[model samples]
Structure formats: structure tokens, C-alpha cells
Target: MTTFGAILKAHHIDYKLTNRSSLDEWFYSILDIPIDELSIFDISRSIRQDVFLEYVLPRAEVFLYEDPLAGDYDGQLLYDISMLTEAQPPSIMAILKRISAYLSQLDKHNLDSQSIKSIEKISALVRN
Candidate 1:
């Protein structure tokens, strides 16, 4: 009876607090991903591997690449995704692309701030 909630916990990703009956339903609705070809598992992994690769860039790939829910997941991840797949098959590549877009934007923001800080430090040294 492995559940998606258990899987998310193993990954240190907590489900957001919601007033809805089912947190999974709430999360999926908020995400509003238009799945058409790929599955949720595929999307999650791609988000970990190719998409958010650098977002989680510092972590070991084992926790992501092989199986994010492999360790302690009950079977909920599969069940939830199965229910979702009933609606529409998602495009695996498209999901990866979408995740990549968000990750790249985040990386740019982080890098820009870091760069500015580094530059400020260097300028202060020159002044001294």
C-alpha cells in the first residue's frame, strides 16, 4: 500500500497544506499539467534528471535517476498516476521541456544574485 504521500516524504518534498479532501487531487489541480503522452512517474523523473537537473544539481543522481520512490514508497505513486493516466497520455519530452524552462529561469535568477554579490565583494577589496 505504498502511497504518493509516502513517496513525497522520502524525497523531502512535503505536500502543501490544503483544505481539499484529497491532497493529491489538490496538488494535481494546482499543477494543471496537460498530460497527453507521458506518465506522471516519467515526468517526475525527467523533472529530476534532464529538467531540474541543476535545480537539484548538487544532489546524488541515485535518489532521482533510478527511482525517486524506490526506497519506501508504498504503491500510491503508481496508483495516483494510474488514475491520472486515465484522463490523458502526456508527452514525456514536453513535460521535460516545461520543467527545464522553469529550472533555467530559477538558475538564472540565482546566478545573477550570486554574481552581483561576488562583484560587490571584489570591488570592495579594490577600494581597500
Candidate 2:
């Protein structure tokens, strides 16, 4: 049987599945949508779409929309990496890591200098 964690991993989304009750609480807290509003299938579909549209697309777009003067940095770096040689590079893993870290910081509600540094680091990593 494919477990919830396996499904998440397959989609390159970083998640930890707890009991149904804890999952319900987390769904409510993060999405602000009640568990009752969604079936398990609905929740799974929503998570898949959310991972793609929210995290993956935006990160990919950032690389695409970089300044021309940047000298095709993202293109060159991608070309250099064998792992990203596909027509549409699989950046879901990187996107998930970034989104996970961002959400964790937001949950803490501590926007200190370290938080700013983290944002800058991620921006630099993606921009190049």
C-alpha cells in the first residue's frame, strides 16, 4: 500500500503524516480549511495541485524571468547539472525544501535578521 508519506515523497513535497486527528489540525491551521470540507481524495488532490502551482511554478518562473544581464546564469547552471537535463527540469524537490523552510519561519512569527538572511540566501540560490 502507498502510504501518505510515500505519496508526498513521490510528489517531492516535504510532509510528515501523523494520526488523522493531527493531520486534521494541521490542515485547519495551515490552510484554514476545515477537514470536514474535504475527503481524503480531495485533500490529496489539493496537496498535489498546491505543491505544483504554489511552490514549483513560481520557483521555475523566477529562473525564467531573470535579468538578461545576469548572463543566462540559471540556464548555464541548469545545463551544467546532469540531474536537470530534462526538457522540463524537475525542480519540485528544491521548491518543496524552500517552501517548507519559508512556512516554518512564518509559523514562528519571528522575522529577525536571520529570517532576512534566509530569504536572501534562497533568493540568491534560485536567482543564479
Candidate 3:
């Protein structure tokens, strides 16, 4: 099934960004946090960026619930991001908007327009 990993794979989005010192630094800050205590509230307390979402999706279950959807990386690709963006940190949602390019590049056949707009609106709320 097309999971987050699958979609990212389609885009050649590197899952191995830990090799970059900047990404590695921010990644570890979140990664090092105790997952058990991790909350959307706390996670966004530090830094919020589109890159971070990409960085965190593979690792979301460490803190958030495993993807509720049975398919698609169990929901890391969209659901958790949906929830976090919906929660409206404003800044977080703003950061999320940065993924627009990636989302646009995603094969249209893989995601329907309605779903795409839904996500766009999620991030756009901060700008509006």
C-alpha cells in the first residue's frame, strides 16, 4: 500500500536526512525527547518547519499514535500531520505550508484534488 514512505519514495524525498548536520541537529532535538512524554504541544514548542515534518513523519509514532489509517504508513504521511496542523499552532501550520511544493509535485493520480485542497487549506489557514 502507498504509505508515507511510499509517497516520499515516489518523490525521492530522502529518509536519510540525518546525514545533514542542520537536519540532524533539529532531528535529534525532537528525537532525543522522551517519546512517552512527547505531545504535539511540546514538540511544536521548539521549532516548526516543513522540513521537520518530513523529518518527523517516519518517526511520529514514537510520540503520536500510530497512523489511524490501516494503510499508508499507518497514517504518518497525512493523518498525524492533519491533526497537528488542525491543532493550529499558527506557526506550525505555517511551517506545514512549506510542503506545498512537495505536495504539488506528488503524482495527482496518487491523491485526489479534494484531499490535496484539504491539506492546502489546512496550511493556508495561517496565511488567510
Candidate 4:
């Protein structure tokens, strides 16, 4: 059977089965709120890039951010960054740029066919 962690990783998401305590600490510290104060659904609201720099990344040994398929039932992509420590800031800007570029392409579907082709090229570049 595929482990949950394996499934997450297969989709380019990061996870650590052994790091729940640290994850909780990083999450609480970043949002300036206790872990118990929020539900899992509330977690995404706290994942701003600035908050990541201030609280979690600096202390983390390693970290990753993923852009999973939209409407993915599993929260793996969004939650993966909490595994990082405060000392190990990941490339948040790079991740955000990639995500923004992807979203921009997705947003261009309302355009004409020629514009859609341009968007496709942009999306391909972002993937690379």
C-alpha cells in the first residue's frame, strides 16, 4: 500500500511523518496563534509568504512548497511548508512566482485562441 507521505510526494508535495510537533510549533509561531485555536481549514489563511519568512523557514532544515491540482481533496501541498525550520528559509519567492505564472495562464482561458496559445507557452515555461 502507498503511504500517505508517498502519495503526497508523488504529486510534488512535501511531508514529514515524524515532524508533527515541529510542524505545530512552526504553524503556531508564524500565525501568532495557538495550534488548537484553529481548524485544519484555517491553516491555509496563515501560509502567507511573509509569515513563512518570519516564523518557519528560518528554523527549518528543509522545506518545499507545491502547486497541486486545483480542488485537491488532500491538503498536502498547502501544508507541506510547515516542516521547515526557522534557520532554513526556503525559496518562497520562487515558489510564488511559479504559482502566479501558472495561475495567470489559467486565467487566460477567456482570451482568444492566439492568446490561449501564448498562455500555454507561458505555462510551459513555468513548468520548466
Task: For candidate 3, give the lDDT.
Answer: 0.45
lDDT of 2 by residue, 21-122 (tens): 854655434342333343333333334334323332333333323421111332232222212212233464466345335433443243445444444444
Q: Summarize candidate 1's per-residue lDDT along 1-120 as a digit string, tens digits.
A: 233344455689866756656634544443424222334454434333243322222222233234323222432222222222112223433333332333333333434443334333
Question: Candidate 2, residue 50: CA error in Å?
Answer: 8.8
TM-score, one value per model: 0.20, 0.24, 0.33, 0.25
| Model 3 lDDT per residue over 1-128, tens place | 32334445578876554466774655545544543344444333322454444334434333322322212333234443554545545554545565443454555455555555545654564455
Off by over 4 Å in 1: 1-64, 68-72, 89-128
Q: What's the number of clashes in each of the models? A: 11, 0, 3, 9
After superposition, candidate 4 runs with Cα above 4 Å error: 1-40, 48-50, 53-90, 108-128
Q: Which scores greater on TM-score, model 1 or model 2?
A: 2
In order, the Cα lDDT scores of the candidates are 0.35, 0.37, 0.45, 0.37
Task: Give me the displacement of residue 124 in model 3, in angstroms.
Answer: 4.6
| Alpha carbon lDDT at 93, candidate 4 | 40
Best lDDT among the predictions, by candidate number: 3
List runs of model 2 lying over 4 Å from the truth: 1-18, 28-111
- Candidate 1 is scored at a TM of 0.20
- Model 4 lDDT, residue 98, Cα: 49
Model 2 root-mean-square deviation: 14.5
